[model samples]
Target: MQPLACRSCGNTVLVAKSSLAHTSVQWADSSRCVEFALAGSLTERAVVSGCTALRASIEDAVRAGRIEVPAE
Candidate 1:
């Protein structure tokens, strides 16, 4: 579970891989305090923007230590 920082936005991003072919991401937003999910192929790059509310909700859950990543 290595953490990544977005170069453009400086957001904290979490990356995890499973048996499935896609990679999952958890991105953090400080303004609204939430984390957002972005999933896509491992071979391609993923970009997320313009979903502030949703991202903030997720970040809030993560900040409260409520997010659960299921076992692969």
Candidate 2:
């Protein structure tokens, strides 16, 4: 896993990308996510999908060579 910070909220999370279609994120404290804490109705969805801002951050990190993906 690699470390990445969300561009929108500045929350740091661990990210791992096995392929273009697969990504895994590990957060030390999910409750600390600003977006997640503000997601009222979407709380359940947030638990499953995680913060969209973080997702985009992971993608950007991958593109910027900050994260590595295994070759298939």
Candidate 3:
């Protein structure tokens, strides 16, 4: 997993890309994510789709070759 920080909110998460369509994220602390924090509770955060900021950051990292995916 590669450590990636969200460009918008700066929360760092461990990311692993298995394929272009598959991504796994491990958050050190879900509460540390500003977007998740705004939801006010862990349950709320769980219901939330995900952090768009972090999604964008991961995409950028993949495009920039910072995160490598294995062959299909």
Q: Which candidate gets the maximum TM-score versus the true structure? A: 3
For model 3, the superposed segments whose C-alpha errors exceed 4 Å read none
Who is ahead in lDDT, 1 or 2?
A: 2
**Whole-model lDDT values for every prediction:** 0.46, 0.79, 0.88
TM-score of each: 0.34, 0.79, 0.90
lDDT string for model 3 (25-64, tens) is 9999777777788999777888988888899899999999
Per-residue lDDT value at 44 in model 3: 81
Off by over 4 Å in 1: 30-72
| lDDT per residue as tens, model 1, 1-72 | 546454335566675544234346664543332222342332222343434543454455445544444456
Q: Which window of ten consecutive residues has the lowest lDDT sum in model 3? A: 28-37
Question: Of the candidates numbered 2 and 3, which has the greater lDDT value?
Answer: 3
| Cα lDDT tens digits for candidate 2, 1-72 | 888888887777888898988998888766667767776555564555567788878888888888998999
Candidate 1 — what's its lDDT? 0.46
RMSD of 3: 1.1
Higher-scoring candidate on TM-score, 1 or 3: 3
